[model samples]
Target: MISFDKFYSLFQKNLQNLYKNSKEIESIFFLLMTHIFKCDKTTILLKLSKKGKIHFIIYKKLIKKLWELKKNKPIQYVIGKAYFFDMEFIVNKNVFIPRQETEELVYWILQDNKNTKNSQIFDIGTGSGCISITLKKKKPKIGHIYAIDFSQKIIDIARKNAKLHNVKISFKKVNILNSDIPIQKKINNNSIIIIISNPPYIRISEKKLLHPNIIQYEPFQSLFVPDKDPLIFYKKISFWIKKKLTGIVYVYFEINQFIYLDIIKFLKKIGFFNIKIKKDFHGFFRMIRAVYYKKK
Candidate 1:
């Protein structure tokens, strides 16, 4: 058995080399304790004040999980779940963890559609189904929500997450990178079409700047684009929209912060107007919105 203080001391010492800030180490420690031991901060503190000791066997289990952390495995992957856009999602090595920045993108969409009703939505690269599921939860009146991903393993996780949220979404396994991939079904001509995507936009050359926790644990294919073609997914999605849809189509993307201007330029070149850019919490221009206007 070990007292909570002693256990915390040992944990901090073990992770000292990995994390430079004491507060970061402490925050991760509490997150691990709450997540792994199923003990919230108050419960753990109360127990520490009263019982003071944790079972040696449980201590070993905690150590085992922390060892993976030392190896740079993300806490969300290690625990098999992540919180995104105010909802909990099941995540694993097979799927990319839903990010807080993407939550900003979701907030923008929800805000824009606050007055909309019975709308149709298509979410491309719906990793863990976060965007579509959150939209359905917040705006239940929206018409059928459709999501697609390239990996069957990722789609499986996304399905489970949608089920967990008790939101109905049509999930499809399709590689949007394939130019020949057709839209699954034609949307109603009069229905409002809202497209959302957070495709892989990281340049391959920027891989060295990423933390090991991301590169080592998160799925690589979902994070990187060829250095020579960082705009490939954006271009493909833009071209597909032009080819497939008509009437008013609102498109949203959680983008690479550095390429916001390039996205605007590309959208203009492709005949998309009413372009808007949004900043993440860090003030990076991390999201873009545009509307395709055509009179029929």
Candidate 2:
């Protein structure tokens, strides 16, 4: 067994090469301790004050995770879980980890439709089912929620997350880019329809701008788009709304900040008016919402 102070010192030293900030290293250390020991921060601090010792088996696990961290693996992936909207989600290499920006996107939807009843929500390119699951959990009055992804493996992970949240989301395996529309069930024409997506908007050329934790660990299919068509997924979703969906339709996207204007322009061209862009906490224009009203 190793004393907590000694183990923490070793942990800080191993993480220094990966994280330049001392506070970040300490934060990660506490996070690891709490996750591994299934205890809270106060308990961890109390143990530390008492000079608690870590069992040999737990020490070995921590060392292995430290090695992964040294490789610049995201702490979320290292722990196999991520927190989003105050909810824990199961994540793996097959699914893109949820981002705080995406949580803002979810909140935007909830704020707009809090009083809405019998609404159908579709989460296109749903990853880990974070957006749909959070919406379902927070807004139980929603009529139905559907989540779609191309990879069956990714869909499986999303299903697991939905199960963990104890929410019923209709998950489907369908490539948004494919010509065939995946949604086939008949819907009430008067019900509000909301479509939300955080699709692959990062251009292939921009891959170098991302960190190793993102480019090396996250699923490639969920992140990159061809440089020539950074808005492919958005375009596809727009066309789907135009061709397949009806009623008072509200569309939301977690957009690439660099292409916010371009996305707004495309949505306007596709007959979606009342478009709005929201800046995230980082002050980047990272989310958009638009509404389409059916002609009388």
Candidate 3:
């Protein structure tokens, strides 16, 4: 067992080798410290720059974990949870570590639905239930949220997250590839205001460009698509909703910035009008939104 200050000093060198960015190292350090000390990161970092001797045993395990991280494993998986959209979720190699961009997607939806009292929002491909849960937290008056995923295990994690947050959300394990979204559930169709997704837009050909953390650790089903047809999920999703949507139904997607025109064309073909492409905070075309309203 090593003392906290001693371990921190030793880990700092390993941190520099493990990550290109100091900030990521800092975050990982804080996350690990919280776990190791069995006290919150804030509590430990704020109160004791040094923890007493039992801390040495903790650092022994932590050093091994840090070695694993340098191999490109996600810290979220290492920590067994992820912070997304200001909420924490149980995460593992079983689920995609929720992305900061997806938080932008949820914030976009919430911003649009701010005036929406009793609005119903659908979070398709609702991995880990981050988007759906965040929506419910931000807009509790929302009539309902229908969240779905293809993986049962991932949905289990999502359900746990919803429970942890004490927010009610309808969850399903049906693969959208073989079946349409379940319309019979708590979807308040009349008030259905938004249909949002952060679907699998990554093309297999583009794999080389992805961060090693995503390529090596994240679930393939949740992160990728066939190179021949990268927009497969979006196309099928659009086809499924064409005849069903009414009211001011809006569809949003977190897009692959490389194929903006292809996505825009697909949106028009699917009958979504007034389509709007939006940039993430970093000014990348990371999201798209469009609306279709039935006749008055």
Candidate 4:
């Protein structure tokens, strides 16, 4: 017979060399191992006592997880899902996981768009389809929404998520790199009222400053652009706005805290008015909202 406390102590000790924060590492291992064993909170106590006697297959799977963590893969990727906007979505190497700050962007849209039954929204770089789907769900009255992405695998997951949640959306597979959305009029009879994006804004310089779990595990295409032109997406978005959005078309973006001032300035120069930058829970310059107003 094995002792629960003793085995846990050994495991924790072995992991200490891998993780500087011993308590968090221990917690991750405990919860993950228990789940791998199919033991809930009630059965976890005694299950540890029989660790060595556990099924070989489950042990092997958990050992694999530990090995991945030792090399710095995010636990969210390992688990194959992540929580966002108070909901769970399938996550993997193919697409970026939905983030909590992005949830705030969705909330802001929902709150501001109470009567969007007739308005049109275009979500550029619709990663995981979180923004587009949430908007459709929140304002079912909306005539239509266009969720654009350049990746097929991510668009596939987004379509699956939309189906799972029973929402209607048009997923467009097109690159927005340098396009000014030449077909804006064809897509909407009424003016496109809103444009939102949490584009790839992380520069190469900042990549070296991120957590190893994210730096190594998450896809660079989703998080970063070439450092030489970190604002590539923003520049294109502003061009689209200046040439396309008329009257009071609202624009929103999730930006790097360090570049908040720079983004706001560019928006102002491009005829964006009433621009605002919002901070996240960590008090970083995280979200920016702007309105495009063309001179009459």
Candidate 5:
């Protein structure tokens, strides 16, 4: 058994050797203690004051997980869970980790639909079903929520997450680029339908600039687009919007910070009228909301 302070000091020193940023070191420490050890920050602090020692078995497990982190594996993947939209989600290498920017996308949708009744939501490329599941959890009045991803394995994980959150959602396996499956065929004319996606928008050319944890561990197909076609998923999903959306169709996307203008232009060309872009916490243009109201 090792004292809490001793354990923290040794673990942080190990992380510091891998990460130059102190904030990252501290954040990882906090995450590991809370998520892995099931001890909150305050609890850990209190334990430190009392010179509490962790069980040797738990300490050994921590050391093993840290070894994976040294290989640039994301801490979320190492722990097999992540927190998004104030809820815990099961995550693995098969899906993209739910991001903070994606939470902003969820926030915008929740705010827009705060007063809305009887709404149907479709999430394209719902990696972990975070967006759709979060919406259903937050706004229980939302009518059918459907999420799709190309990988059946990924859809299974998303479905599990929805179950974990105790939210009802439909998870489907469909490649959005080739899918013609109409979502929610029997919606009432007055019901608002929102479609949201946080598709792969990073350019392959910019791949090297991303942190090793993301590029090395997160699913490559979910993080990057070909340099020649950075907006491929956006364009394909936008075309789907043109096809299947019949009601007051509101579209939301978490986009690559660099190509938001391009996305805006594409939406305009595709006849989406009321389009808006939003910035994330770092003030990067990371989300866009557009509307296409069907002719009355």
Candidate 6:
């Protein structure tokens, strides 16, 4: 057994060579300790203040997790879960870990449709079902929610998350770029439809710019797009909305800040209007929302 303070010192020391920022290292340590201890950070700190001694078995587990972190594994994957919109989600290498910016996207959707009734939401490329599950949880009265992804493995992970959250989301294996939109023929004229996605927007060339942790641990299918057509997913989705969906539709996207202007232009060209861009906490334009009216 070792004193909590000493254990934390050892933990920080082992991570120092890999993580340069002291605060970041500390945050990682807290997440690991909380996961291992199955308690909140406040309780962990209280134990540390009282010189808590960690059992040898627990210490061994902590060391193993630390080693995983040192190998550039994402903390979320290392821990097997992530928190989004203040809810816990099951995550793994098969799915893209949820981002804080996406919470803003969810907030935007809920804000615009707070009083909406008989609405349907579709989450495209919904890895881990974070967006679709969250929207359903926040607005249980929404008529129906659907989420689709390319990989059955990814869809399975997303279904697990939906079950974990106890939210009903229709999960489907779909190659969004090639598969026919599954819900296209089910649209009800009087019902509002909201389509939202955080699709692959990072150009493959930008891979070098990302941290090894992200590039190494997250699924490439969820992250990278060909540089020749970084907007491919956006274009496909816009085309789907233009040709398939109808009547009082709203669309939201977690966008690449660098190409937001290009996205807005394309949406306008496809007849989506009332387009608005929202800046995330980092002050980058990371989300877009637009409205479309289709006459029957």
Decoy 5 TM-score against native: 0.95
Name the regions of candidate 1 deviating beyond 4 angstroms: 48-51, 179-186
Model 6 lDDT tens row, 1-296 = 88899988888888788778999899888888888899999999998999989899988888899889989998899999899987999999999999999998999888988888778888999998988888888888876888988999998999998889898888878797887677746667678888899999999888898988998889988999998999999999888888877787889999999889999998898788999999999999999999998787
lDDT of 1: 0.86
lDDT of 5 by residue, 8-30 (tens): 78877777877999888778878
TM-score, candidate number 6 = 0.97
Candidate 4 has its poorest 10 consecutive residues by lDDT at 182-191
Candidates in order have lDDT scores of 0.86, 0.88, 0.81, 0.76, 0.85, 0.88
Please identify model 4 stretches exceeding 4 Å from their true place.
1-19, 22-54, 182-192, 294-296
Give me the displacement of residue 168 in model 2, in angstroms.
0.9
Task: Show model 6 residue runs off by greater than 4 Å.
Answer: none
Clashes of 6: 0
Over 4 Å off, model 2: none
Q: Name the candidate, 3 or 6, with the larger TM-score value.
A: 6
Deviating ranges (above 4 Å) for candidate 3: 46-54, 185-190
- Name the top TM-score candidate: 6
Question: Ten consecutive residues with minimal summed lDDT in candidate 2?
Answer: 179-188
Task: Give the Å shift of residue 152 in candidate 4.
Answer: 1.2
* RMSD, every candidate, angstroms: 1.7, 1.4, 2.3, 3.4, 1.5, 1.2
Per-model TM values vs. the true structure: 0.94, 0.96, 0.91, 0.84, 0.95, 0.97
Backbone atom clashes (below 3 Å) for every candidate: 0, 0, 3, 1, 0, 0
Per-residue lDDT of candidate 3, residues 43-102 (tens digit): 767544646554556556887888877787878888898898667898988888888888
Residues 219-271, candidate 1: write the lDDT tens digits: 98899998888899989988888887778999999898877788899899889
The alpha-carbon deviation from the true structure for residue 165 of candidate 5, after best TM-score superposition, in angstroms, is 1.5
- Pairs clashing within candidate 1: none
Which pairs of residues collide in model 2?
Answer: none
